[model samples]
Target: MSKILDKLKVVELTTFVAAPTTGRMLADWGADVVKVEPLEGDFFRGYGKGLNVPADTGENPLFDMYNSGKKSLALNLKTEEGMAVLHDLLKDADVFITNNRTKALKKMGIDYDSLKQKHPRLIYATITGFGDKGPLADAPGFDTVAFWGSSGALVDLSIETGNSYPLNTPAAVGDVASGTNLFGAIMAALYARELNGKGDKVTVSLYGSAVWSMSFMNVIAQEKYGYKYPKKRYEVNPTAAPYRTKDNEWIMLTILDHDRYFPSLCEIIGRPELSRDPKFIDKIALLNMDNRKELMQILEDAFNKKDAHEWHLLLTQKDIVHDILKHFKDISTSEQAMANNYMSEFAFPNGQKAMLAKPSLQSDNLGEIENFRGPYLGEQSISVLDRLSYSKAKIEELLSKGIIKQ
Candidate 1:
C-alpha cells in the first residue's frame, strides 16, 4: 500500500538526534526527505566511532537508524552560491527542518522569518536547546544538558542521599522524545495548512520536552499537595518498585491499585498469610509510612528467594503488573519489541543482518519498504541537482567550485 506522506517533500537541514529523528519519521511515512549536509557530512556520522564501533565498520547502524531512506545533498552553506542552491530546493518543498542555533540561523538568512516570507506555503520546523526568547536561547545543548539537567529532571531523578548523584538515563532519550513532539507539531501544522492554504512555523525545545515529560512531579510540587519525592525504600507504593531476585536480576512491579491486587500479589509470592495480617490487610493499613517500610522489607526478602525470570513468569500468569528490568543487550532479541514493531531486522551493505530500531508507527498498508543504507556524503547531489534543472556542465562547474558535492 502507498505510504502516508508520499506526496510530501522535506528538506532536512538538521544534525544529531532531535531534528533528524523527525526527518526520519517523515521519511518512514514516505516523504521524499532530502538531508542537506555540509561537505563533511552530518557530525553524527562519526558518533558511533566514539561509542567504540570500529572505524573500519562498513556501516554505522546508529546513523542509519536515524537517516535511512533519505537522499543527501552536500553543500557549502557558508558560501552564497550554496545558500542559493538551498533556496532553490526549498522553493517547492513542503517542509524545512533545522536545529541550528538561533543566532547562526538568523545570520545565515534561513531563519523562519526569512523562509516563511519567501515560501509562504512551507512548513518551517525548528528544534532548539531552549525556547527562542529565553536568556539561554542561543546556548548550545545536547540531550544531557538541555533535556536532563536544565529541565529539572536530574533533580527529581537524584537519590535523596546527600552524596548521591543524579541518575543518568539511556542515551538520547530526551532527544528521541523531543523528536516525536516535533513530529506531532509538524503534522498538526500540515493539517492547519490544509484548512487555510498557508503553512506555519513549528518549534520545540529539548528543555521544554524534558520538562513536559516530568510535568507530573512538577504539578504535584506546585499544587502544594504535600507530595515529596521518595527514596526507593520509602516509595508511596512499596509494591511499585524494583527488587533484586536470587539471580541478581531486578524485577519491577507497578500495581497502582493496591487495594485490588495486594491479595493476589501476596499469594503469588507465597506470602498469603501476610494478606490478612493487621498491618498489611488493606490498602489503608499498608499506606501508613511505617507499614509501607515493613511491607517493603517483607517483599524484598520474599523476592530474593526467586530468580527474576521466575517472577516474570509468575507475575504474568497472575496478571500482576510487573516486568523484568531489561538490559540493553536483551532489547535486540526481545519478543515484545519485535511483535510491536519497535525493532526489526535489516541487512547492511556488508550483507550482515542486524536488528535496528524502527519508527514507532506500524501499518499493514505501508507497502514494501525499500532496502536502503544511509547515504554517503552528498551521495545524491547530482540527481538532486538534476531535478532542479541544472545542466550537466553547470553541475560539474559547481562541483569544481567546491559549492556542491556528489
Candidate 2:
C-alpha cells in the first residue's frame, strides 16, 4: 500500500525522546528516515539499563518506542569528513529533525541558518528544553524540568496530594507531547513548502508545549477571575472530582451540567431529598464554597457504599459521564484500544513479546501501518554510504579513521 509520506526523505540528528518521536511518526507514515547518531551511539540507547533492562539484548523497548522504523548511520560529526557525509545525506533530504542543544548544533555547523544556506528546501524541525532563543536556550532540558516543573504542571497536579511533595512525572510524557506537536508543525511546513517552493524552520520547546497543554486551566487562573491553582478537592466542583468506591477503586465523574444530573445523581445514591434541599438545590447553590464542600462529602459517602463495578453499571444506565480509573497495565487489554489498533503486539528478534502503542491519527486512505524493530548502532552505515555514491575504498578509509561506524 502506498503511504502518505512515501516520497519524503528525513534525516534525524537527535537523542532521547522528543525529536526521535517525530522521526518515528514520519517513518511510520512511509517516509524514508535516516537516524544519524554519533560514533558512540545516541545516549538513549543505554536508557534501558537505568530501568534494569539489558541494553544489549536487542529488545530495548523504551529505545525502540521512539527510534523504530528508521535507518541508523553512526557518524562523528566533530570530524570534517563526517560533517561532509551528513551534508551529502541532507542534500536531497526533505526534513532535518533534532533535539540537540542550540550551542552544540551551532558548534557542529548544522544549525538552521547553516543548513538553510546549503539545503534551502529542507524543513528544519527542532525540539528544545526551552525555546530557540532565551537565556536558558543552551541549558539542558528534560521533560521533568522543562515540561512538568517549569510549566507549573508539577505544582498544579500536586494539589490532590496536598503539595507535601511534588509528583514525579512519568518518563518522557512531556517529550512525547512536544514531539507530537512538532509533527503537526512539520506537516504544516511541508504543505507551505509545496505551495511556496521554500522550506521553513519549525521549533517546539518542552516548556512551551507544557504551557500550551495547561492553557485551559491557566487562562482561568488569573486574579481577576478569582481562580487559583493547587485547589483542594472540596474547593473544586463536587461532580467533577474523583471518588473512592466501596471496593477501594477510584472513578472520576465529569458532570459538567450539574443541574441536569443533580436530581438523577441524588436518586441513584439514595439521597433524593438532598436534591430538593435549598442548600443543594441547584448549580448556583453549589457555587457557595460551604455548600460545595458539603456536597462533596455527601457524594463521597454515597459512592463509598457501592463497588466501582456497581457504580459503572449505574452510571452507564443513566448516561452519566464517568469512567473507572485504569492503570497503565490495564490499557494493553482495553477492548476499545485493541479494536482501534491503538495498542499493538510485536515480537522482537529474540522472541520477546511486547505491546506497543500506535499513532492516534487514523486515515481512511491507509489503514494500520506495520510495526518494525529499531536499528542497531550504525546498522545501515554501509548501505547509506554506498547509496551516497561513496567509493568502497573511501568508505573503508572513513571507517578506519573513526569518522563513521558500522
lDDT of each: 0.86, 0.89
* Candidate 1 lDDT over residue span 247-338, tens digit each: 99999998877767888899998888887889887777866889888999999899999999889989998789988898898999999988
- What tens digits encode model 2's per-residue C-alpha lDDT throughout 115-187? 8977889999999999978798878899999998887777776766533567778789899999999999999
Best by TM-score: 2
Scored by lDDT, the top model is 2
- The positional error of residue 203 in candidate 1, measured at the CA in angstroms, is 1.0
Clashes of 1: 0
Backbone collision count in every prediction?
0, 0
Each model's TM-score?
A: 0.95, 0.97
